[model samples]
Target: MEWHNWSGSVSAQPRTIARPRNESELRAAILATPRVRVRGAGHSFMPLCETDGTLIDMSDYDAPIEIAADRASAWVPAGWSLARLTETLWKEGVSLINQGDVNPQSLAGATATGTHGTGKDLGSLSTQVIAFELMLADGSLVVCDAEHHPDLFQAQRLSLGLFGVATRIRINVLPAYYLEERVEARPLGEMAERWQELAAATRHFEFFVFPYADTVIFKSLHPIAGEDEMPHSTDIDERPFRVACELGRKANFLIPPLQRLMMRLSSKPSRRVGPAWQIFPGERTIRFEEMEYELPRADGIPTLLEAIGYIRRKKLPVAFPFEFRLVAGDDIWMSPFNRGVGSSISFHQYARMPWRALFAEIEPVLRGANGRPHWAKRHTLGPDQVHALYPKTGDFLKVRAEVDPAGKFVNADLARLFGIERK
Candidate 1:
């Protein structure tokens, strides 16, 4: 059977697909195939999980989460989705420090791809990993952390599942808390001027701006002192928005007017108070192809303005809103936020519409601004571009070679990105 990602943008035909029930079975599968790639919740837009050899699905391995007695950390199964993990953590009186808006991604996939949430003080999900157990190509297991196998730890944090398959991960967590969420609409100009201030003041902040519209939907999440009493509302319904997107796709000329109308009709201020986990994730039911780039915090506004100008000038048939968020710096080798505070800008197009041309045209603008593509998002960077942007590219490649010298984990797309030659 053919495997496709959530957005249906990427597909793979693996020679074999294996769902290992335990570590021993997983090790056997790895040793049986010359090439292997792991598929999580199939949330990535890129072809990272595509392979012609063997595809390992970790969902069948449901290991119990082991929380530390001090409530400072937990040993979690890599196969668990963020939604499950966060729910479990909350039950144990703890929660993840930060997490992206969407919660369907598996823990290992999110960490390996450097997935992050919006905040000035919090780094990507990968940064929360205190230790992990990696199964190498040779089926040899090794435990790595900051104090032991330090280099491997740095590389594995955002390893792209290239170094090996992560079976279990120990993550630093915080005591369970409640959050107050506020969503409002504001003029784009106001947001541009106060982005920094807003990010600094809120525990989590992000905004969504539709093309051809002057308004932005601003959202802020802040921790509160009291426990939450209100039931969480998971707004997973996107039928109304999906209808708008379809109209935009079919009419093309209606994009601008439709976007403006939608903004006006749906821009009402809303509030929600709930547990941190409940408030952190947003329901994402609409399918779309996305391309996100992480730029220096200083260049976010200018780059976004340029992108908007380009879209309006070219009249690109895109209707999905552009997403903006902040992420703190980290030291992970392949993390886009490595050593620099970042502002992530995401461009999304309705799944049925044409996006390649639009993405091709705007990529140069982002690249010119020294933006680095998110590992799981769409981008056209080759090894040279990747190496130019990431100073530790060589180090990461060296470590990858040391662990999987035969390049057993590399597929065609990864080979091009990492400049790895398959044996």
Candidate 2:
């Protein structure tokens, strides 16, 4: 069966794709093959799910959400999409601690890959995990938390789909709340100097800047006082942006002007009020290939500006605006933000166009700032760089060896990335 990601950038023709409706079936599917990989919503840009062997499709799995007695957290089904999970949680009067710009990714996929949203003090979804129920390659299920199997739990927080297949995840939650999304135009220079202040002042703050533009779109999501009549929002129509991307794909020369023009047209301030789950993500229809870097808090803006400066000076025609956000640090062994706070910079290009050279040139700027790539995103990091950037690689590899020494969970991409033999 041919399987591809949402953006159609990565494709795989697996020999078998099994949709397991329950844990027993899932185990059977896993044990039936020498090699296996889970297929989430396929939001990852890299070939994390590319497998020539069995591919376990978890979309059919539907375990009940067991809310903790105190309601501070819940045991959520690992395969549920963020869209499904967050909406279901909302019905239960709870919501995820935070979510990224889109919600179609699976709960396990998002947490495993260190996916995150923007907040000065809030860590990524991986940090929200208090425990995990993982099925080992031998089909045995083990539950690990901070107090039980802590080493395994630490590595599982951002396991990158290596340690095992997460069957259930215990994550932190917040009582249902409302958020106000405010987007306005601001000068890049002013923002560069004070973005940290902006981040500290809001519940979530992020900004988008075109490589050649001097202004940025500042978006902040903050809690609203009460649930009242939601204010009307003049959301910028996305159709024009799609058209611009198509134009840029055909004639790269127009990308610079198109971006600046769109920035001008998109300058109008907009406001909307909705549930936290609804407000956290926006509609993302335009497809683009992305490479994201997680840098130290102090280096994020500097790295972004340097890359943008290079883009302008080189007259590189990048289609999408750069997204910059802040994420708090965590202790997850494989997480990019493990040691300290992070500044996340996402570089995107219309997938229809050439990107090898573009990202090739820009990635060094990020790397030079001591930035680490999100495991799921596109990057040229080899095994050496992986070990150098993530000092915990040795520890994680040790855990993987202990749990699945036969390498049942190792796919081609992962085997090469982690220097593990494909068994």
Candidate 3:
């Protein structure tokens, strides 16, 4: 059988696929294959999970969530999806500090890729991990945390599943809370001018700017001291937007007009009060190929403007909105936001439409701004480029070697990513 990622951008026909129901099974599978790649929910757009070797699917490892007595942390199954984990946490009267717009990604997958939510004070998902239980390529289980195996902890937090298979993850969480979500529209110029001020004013803030239109949709999520109320409506309905994307995909010339119409018809302000988890993620029904880059917070607006200008000048047939967000930095060696405060600019195109040329043209603008591509998104960077952008690349490589000396987990893409010669 063949396997494809969520966006269908990457596919693989593994020599063998294993559905490991327990650690014993997982360890056996790992030891049996010379090359292995663990797959979570398959949300990544990159070939990180693609391998002609063995593919270990951990979804069947349905372990129960273990909450700490103090309610400050929880040990969760790494295979659980964000939606499942957050829902369980809510029932336990705790919640993750932050989360991205979509919730289908697995916990290990999200952290491995440094997936993040929008907030000036919040770091990426990897930062929330307190510890990890991994099965090394030799089929030995090791527990790593800030205190035990500190270097391994830092590298494993965002290791791209290159170090080992994370079986369990301990995450720091907060008491369950309510959040008030507000969304409104504004001109792109005005929003960009006041981006910092606006971001600082809210607990979570992000915006989406239509490619051909001047309109921007501003979204803010802040904690509120009140009982949760059932939201009257979802934050944003994607059905209409999905239809617009389909139309834009079919008729390239109609993209601009479709974008204008969608922005005009969907600019109404909306507010909703709900549990933090419920309010954090928005609806995403449309399938699209995405490319996101994390740049110095100061370079966000200028880089975004340059991307928009380039798109307009090229008359690219793009209709999906450009997503802009802020993220706090962490010390994880492989995290894109490892260098202090950062801002992310994301570009998307309907899955059926060609995105390579469009992304290829805009990648230079992002790279010129000293940006690092998100690990799970579409990116063209290879080993040399990656090393140039991430100063700690050697450190991560050292840890990878120590953990998987035989290169049992190194696939073709991983080999190129770390500049390793396959034995």
Off-target runs (Cα >4 Å) in candidate 3 are: 226-228, 232-234
lDDT of each candidate versus the true structure:
0.90, 0.88, 0.88
What's model 3's overall lDDT? 0.88
- After superposing all C-alphas onto the true structure, candidate 2 shows an RMSD in angstroms of 1.4
lDDT tens readout by residue for model 2, 1-423:
799998898999888999989889988999888889998988899999998889887867867799998899999999999988999999999988888988889999999899999998899999898999989999999999999998899898998888788888999998988888889999999999999788888999999999878999999999886566374433457899999989988898888788889988988997888888778887787788899999999988888889988998898878888899999998788889988988999999887877777899899888889999999999988899999988888999999999998999998899889888875
lDDT of 3 by residue, 107-197 (tens): 9999999999999999999999999998999888999999999989989999899889988999999999988988898988899788888
For residues 174-265, could you state the per-residue lDDT of candidate 1 as single tens digits?
99988898888999999999888888888999999998899999999998965545778873347778889999888999999988987887
Alpha carbon lDDT of residue 188, candidate 1? 95
Task: Assess candidate 2 and give its lDDT.
Answer: 0.88
Number of clashes recorded per candidate: 0, 0, 0
